[model samples]
Target: MKNDSTPITKSRGPAEHEVRAQIVAAATEHFSHFGYEKTTVSDLARVIGYSKAYIYKFFESKQSIGEMICGNCLREIEAEVSAAIGQSDQPPEQLRRMFKACTEASLRLFFRDRKLYEIAASAATERWQTVIVYEANIQRLLREVLQAGRLSGDFERKTPLDETTMAIYLVMRPYLNPLLLQYSFDYTEDAPVQLSNLVLRSLSP
Candidate 1:
């Protein structure tokens, strides 16, 4: 008996995924190098040796590809933060590691495709919402990590955990500039060291 409502069972297939991954990898590289405005569908197709219509079969448009890339970056950052937290034995250390991991993840994503980020930033009209959602999700993940630290007595916070988390996010947001900027940079070698000190000092013992 054939069931018309049965969903296709292709989720575990490697070939389909590999093709899609290749497409995304090509698109990511193109977008990072050429940016959204400067990048075109033809460029992506040509790079991957696929026709324009073939690329369309996988991605509806360049914006769709950008959205997927942003999603991938967020997922990677989330995974890094999770792995750092999982590896730390001390709650306080976990808190410190979480911040450092977040910073590292941000730098990796920004540097992975510098031009793409610039394009996403510049095309406020196209990618503004996507970027906002990406950042907001990261903040939520960070807030959850902070809440865990507070629960473990690692964080001695007089202020609400949510408030403190928001403050931290605000402070670190500016640090992304050096990661994105190409010229002379004022490196914050002690950023993690300072963050650990600030958080421990602020928290109740």
Candidate 2:
């Protein structure tokens, strides 16, 4: 799902955007209530009071709805990280804050809307467009932070920037990857700050 706008394919009849919105709104509540895994397209149609054929006009499968919902949640987490990064000028501090904010926001999501987490796992495993874009944004953020760090001598210039950025992403992946995050969550209580500090020390010039 595109973050800015939901794309509408060619259609006839009622406004396609509106219909999709209606379906999505109903589906959102339904997924939250009944959870995503067991809910079938038929179940969703019944829950939303629409025929399965009507729903199929907008979404090809149940996974599409879950992808959109999961996309929105990933965007929310990205927004939290961006806000955290903006709060500090020092690259090292920004990096630490990015980790901290991401972990906190995701943990809050985990505790509050676990069904979404399952959707995320599915999205990640499927390598959906939403997941691809989400990961790219994260890597972009890391590259920016590292570029600033190198300029400020907060990080070493010996390593290639791409390599450094990738290494950092890999280090943070366990907490970031929803497929593995719940498993990683147990050790993450104090790990965000601690891990960031360790990475910062290694980056220090």
Candidate 3:
């Protein structure tokens, strides 16, 4: 007689997560090669060797996958910047390092998954109003850094801290924007150096 009471083996949670990750990897490649407007869910599904319905089970749609991919990129930036910000005792140095990390991280991570970058860049162009809202939040975070520096007497500016922060962001905009970097003169060697020099000079008492 068999032991009918034995429990059935469940699907491993790690395996499920691995599947989800593979789906994202495949989607990123498809989007990068073809760009957002030209890619289709079927393409992603085919590359991953999964049915469209199964892919939908992991993600509701292609846009949903794009959001996840972009969110992963942002999280990486946040983590690196947060660490650099925390490590320095000097406010000006912290600000300088943060900007450097932001620029480098954006370049490295943005190009890592090319298809996703193309898709996101195209979508952002068409939906800039929404993109501005996201950008505003990032600007606000930078404002807080400026406020801290002002309180520390590390930065002296006639304008409000928020305004100064916005100006700093505007200055860095072209260097930080991936699309702009592709067209602009290469600053790979000097962008961070020039940025730090400008910040240091502007903030000196």
lDDT at residue 189 of model 1 (Cα atoms) = 54
After superposition, which runs of candidate 2 have C-alpha atoms over 4 Å from their true positions? 1-15
RMSD of each: 7.7, 3.3, 10.5
Q: TM-score each candidate.
A: 0.71, 0.89, 0.75
lDDT for each of the candidates?
0.64, 0.80, 0.67
Model 3 alpha-carbon drift over 4 Å, by segment: 1-22, 32-35, 57-60, 112-114, 127-137
lDDT of 2 at 107: 76
Candidate 1 vs candidate 2, TM-score winner: 2
Local lDDT at 29 for model 2: 84
Q: Summarize candidate 2's per-residue lDDT along 1-205 as a digit string, tens digits.
A: 1123222233334567878878878888887777888789999899789999988887878888777777767778888888889999999999999889878887776547776567777778888877787888888888899999999988999999999999989989888887778788787888898899999998988
Q: Following a full C-alpha superposition, what root-mean-square deviation does model 3 have from the true structure?
A: 10.5
Worst 10 residues of 1 by lDDT: 1-10
lDDT (Cα) of model 2: 0.80
Candidate 1 has an lDDT of 0.64
* Cα lDDT tens digits for candidate 1, 1-205: 1111211112222446667778888887787677767888899899999998877776767766766666566556667777887786666776677677767776666666668766545533454445566556657666766777777777765787678888877766644332333331244456766866786676655
Cα lDDT for residue 109, candidate 2: 68
